[model samples]
Structures are given as C-alpha cells and as structure tokens.
Target: MHNATVIALRTVATILILATFVPLLPFEAWYIRIFDFPRSQIFVLAAFTLLIFLVLRWWRYGIDKILIPGLVASLVFEAVNIYPYTFLSPVQVQQAPADAPADGQLSILVSNVYQHNVEHQLLIDLIQEHSPDILLTLETDSIWQKGLRPATDSFPERVAIPLSNTYGMHLYSKLPLRQTRTRYLLEEEVPSIKTYVQLRNGVWVELHAVHPKPPVPTEDDDSKTRDAEIVLVGKEVKGSDYPVIVAGDFNDVAWSHTTTLFQKVSGLLDPRIGRGFYNTFNAKYKLLRWPLDHVFHSDHFKLVKMERLPHINSDHFPILAILSFAPENKYEQEEPQPDEDTAEEAAETIEEGKEEAQEEDD
Candidate 1:
C-alpha cells in the first residue's frame, strides 16, 4: 500500500511537470495555448509534489532519484519564469521623481468590462473615484455604452465603437485628442483605437488601445490572428519618435512569447516587470488568475503610480497607471530590442496576417 501510494503521487507529479511544456509548443491549439496562463499554479503544484516525494524518501536510490531531480527542475523552471514579475527582480520602468512636475503627468485607467455584466454603477463609481486622465473600456456593447454615457459626458474626447460580438471598445479622455483613428486591424470584428493626446504640458503622446481575441475553442481556434494583430502594431510603432502608451486586455499572459516579442519589436516597456504580475482576470477564482490586462509604455516616461482597482462585477479588475513624461530619463530605463531572429519572426507574423487578409478578399 505504501509503495502504491508513492507510485500514484509520482505519476501525478510527472503529469504536473510535463503540463508546463504544453505552452512551449509552436502549435496554437486552445489546450496548448491555455497552459501559458498558470505558471504560478504549476509552480505551487510542483513544489507540493516535490515535498511529498521528499517526505516519502522517494529519493532513496532507484528511479526515485531521477524522478525527484526532475521534480526539482520543474519547480525551478516555473520559479524562474515568475521571478521577473516579483519585487525581487530589478525594476524595468523607473519610478518618477517625487517632485516631477504635474504638467508632465498622465493617468490612465483600463478596464475589460465583461459585456454581459450589468454592474455599470460600480464601474462608474470606480472611475469617478480615480478620475484618470484617460479611460479605455473593452467588451462594451451598445448597452454598456448607454449605461456609461452619463459618466463619460465629462470626458471631452471620446471614441466609442459599440458592437454586440464582445469585441466592442470605448476610449474616453479629458485631454484633447488629435489625429485619432479607429481601425479594424485584421479581423473586421476586432477594433483598435489610435490617437495622439495633447498632455497638460502641451506635449502630444501617442496611445493605442487594443483588445485582441483570445485563443479559445469558441473565440479563435488559434492565436494566429491575435499574434498577428499585435505584431502589426509593434511594426507600426517600431521607429516612431513619439512617446507611446499601449493599453488593453491583451488576453495573453505577461510571460508569453508573443507578448515578449511585441515588447521587443515595439521597443515598449512593461511596468509590471519586477512589479508583480498584478493578475487582473478570473476575479472570482484566485488560482486561475493571471495578468491579462496591461499597460506598456515607451522608455521616455517614468512610472507615477499603478494599481489593480477593486472588482466591479467583471471578470477582470480594472488597472490604472500614472506615467510622467520625462524625455530626459528615456535612456535611464532599458527598452526591449528585438534581435535579428526575433525581428524576422515578427515580420513573418505580420506577413501571415496580410496573407490572411488577402485570402479573405479573394
């Protein structure tokens, strides 16, 4: 009975360890893609398994020795992936000086208001309390737009694309908007908003709001479309001289390969790096939570404040960030740069998207 128990535990441990590799596969099947969302859970499971095996003296010679080490390795691997997002890691985006002029500051609030959710007042209250300079909401249909209308009246510049398919987006800003464009990037259903906002200091900062479809059995069979959309945006911002801020519910994890590539190609910096995952999704399930909503900015700005706001009856908790434009400190933070191989991969992703578009046209 004792040996049998050990064998069962060992088997379960092996499965947990191997599950981590599913996300590493180049394929984009929903099952494979989902494995990328639970690195923290995997780490916990691996650690528990390792502890149990150690207590059972499973490392006392035989194949148990090999299995024990394997478990250790698996635990270590997950830890490494999550370490960068923790406070222990070096800060990726430097904090703004306490005395930084208010004229150079900008606060943004991003929320993925689940379309079916009807708690509009909660969201409205949250927004009123924070009163960010810019607000972007995702999954907003006509109902959400109507519900939010009263609160948004205060925002002088607004971009509302109301849709029923859960891909709806809205941008409300108090700052003056110049040269704003609403685009249906790859999929006609998935829309993105790009605009230049004149900051308080009279400096214009480029902002892009996107909410890509997730790799799921129902929404999208693979991540191709989502990856392509992000890559194309990265390509657009690659050589731009303007200070940029990209915000949205990316539906992708912070540690995923595609997000890393996007950051590198676009030269944007994720403030979450070394600042904790700030997991925003699966608000009801603690174990299933991961950072899906993000705010990536150019190195020309420094972090003023970042917080995961209280849940407003949505699956995602809104994220708010305040950034101070400091061109002089641009070089203080290291920007992500794509290597030759990564650049080629980004190009290929963009090309694949164009080809998909051509096929649709044909």
Candidate 2:
C-alpha cells in the first residue's frame, strides 16, 4: 500500500510537470488556458514545482518510484523558463550613454490593454510619462483604438488590426515604419507585426511583435497552433543577419519550453538572467502571477534597464524595456537544440494542424 501511494504521488507530480507545457499549447481543443482552465497558470506551475520537492524526499528513503521521471521533467521545464523567480524588482534606466547619438537609443513598450478596460485617460498618462519609441497594444478593439487615437497622433506611423473580439492588436511607432507586414501568426486576424525601426544610427533591425492566444477551455486555447506559429516566426529569423526583437503578451511564462524554444530558435537574448523576473499578468490576484508579457532581443544590444509600469485598468501591467545600441559579437553563440527527435514531433504536430485546417476549409 505504501509503495502504491508513492507511485500515485509520482504520477501526480508528472501531471503537474505536464502543466508546464500547457502554455505552449493552443486553446482550441484543450481547456488549459487561464480563461478555460480550472485554475491560473501560476497555481498549476507552483504546484508542479512543489511536487519536485515532495518526490525528491524519496532520496532519503532510497525509494524511487517516480523520482527519476519527475526530476528529469522538472529540470527540462525550468531550463526553458525565461525567468521563474519574482525577486526581480525594477531597475532604473541608465542616465546617459557614452557617445550617445543625437537620436538616442530606441525604446519599446508592450501592453496587453484589456478590451473592457475604460481607463483610457489613465493609459494616456502612463504613455506620456514613459514615451516609448514603439508601442504594441493587445486586446484593443475599435473602441479602444478610438480612445487611443489621441495618443496615436504623437506617433504618426502605425499598424492597426482592431477586432470587437478580445484578440485585436495594434502597433504605433515614433520611428520610421519601415517594411511593416502583418501576418496571422497563429490564427486569422490575430495579427503579428513584422517591421523595421530605423535607428538614429541609420541602422535598422527587424522586429516581430506577437500576442499568442492563451491556452484556455472556452477560447481557441489549443496552444499547438499558437506554439507552431510563433516557432515558425523564430525559424524565419534563424538565419537573418539583422538584429531581432520579439516581444509582447506571449501568454506563456518566461520559464516555459515554448518561450525558450522561441528564444533559442530566434537567436534572441533574454536579459532577465542575472536580472529579474517581471510578472505582468493577473493584476487582480497577487499570489497567482507570472511573467506573461516579455521583450527578447538579439545580443547586438546591451541591457540598459527594464521597468513595470502602473496599472491602467487592464488585466495586464505595462512592461517597458529601455535598451541601447551597442556593437555586440554575433559570434557569441548559443548552440541550437532543435533536437532531431523534437523537430520530428513538432513536424508531425504541424502536419496534423494542416490536416485539421484543410478539413475545416472543406
């Protein structure tokens, strides 16, 4: 009976580990996304991480029913998190840059402004204070766009993809809106903007702004489609010589395999390491929180500072990153681990999606 109990506990641990991958999946088939799931990602993730502690106790007794599997699962899971710890408080932006160009370093702001949120003035106040060079807003319907029109005048260049549904997205830029193209990364009309921001230095780097649908029960939450779409974007950037910046409401935490794969596949650098984890979602609940929004870049830039802005009547808090243009060694490489086996699995999944999409078309 005792041995059975141990095995049962290990199985539970395994299920929790499975939750780590939930954010990577889509919302259509599975009911795992926050909107449809039984609980928040924070709760499931914490429980799974705790399970590691519980199963680790077997080492003391020399009993190992599910210990090995649980440990392996947890290790792989944590290895992929962008940053799981919340100890990261805000850091002040650098006062000045040596030989700073006249145009100054470019700054990007990402916010998942809830559709129902009415605090348009509050958001305006925050925007005026931060003044990002480029801004990406999610869940912005036509109403929200109208409310934001006043602010849009300040940044003449813009890309607007508004929807009455909660998935609408938009981008406004103070920099030259060079070569902007909107792609339906995961789903139709759920747009992701790929553009170039002409820097003050006369140099330009590619930018990919994405707001993948969270895996949920009622919504399109099967993250398989979402994950593949985002991964394909990373694949698009795999061989590009242009520095890349991919940011926005990923719905996945910093510590998930999907996000890590996005980072690895895109050759992007995460500054959170030796830094901090800035949890941006679930402003309603303190205990249940993780970094759902993110900003990742290529190593060509130096980390100047990153900050979390005040709540502006949205479910998500605004995350702003102030980065500088510094020449970096492109050769400082991270070995790609798109393991052959994993690629084959992902390929199979993609083929399945194509089949499903075709059937739906039929």
Best by TM-score: 1
**Candidate 1 lDDT by residue in tens digits, 1-362:** 48798678878877886787767777767788888889999899888888887876768867778778888887888888899899999989998999999999999999999999999999999889999999999999999999987789899999999999999999999999999999999888789999999899999999999998998988877787788888788878877779999999889998888898999899999998888999999998888999999999999899999999999999999999999999997998999877879978998887876676556557
TM-score of each: 0.96, 0.76
For residue 263, what is the lDDT in candidate 2? 62
| Candidate 1 Cα misplacement greater than 4 A, ranges | 1-4, 61-63, 354-362
Candidate 1 lands at a TM-score of 0.96
Per-residue lDDT of 141 in model 1:
97
Clashes of each: 0, 19
Worst 10 residues of 2 by lDDT: 87-96
Give me candidate 2's TM-score against the actual structure: 0.76
Query: Model 1 lDDT vs. the true structure?
Result: 0.89
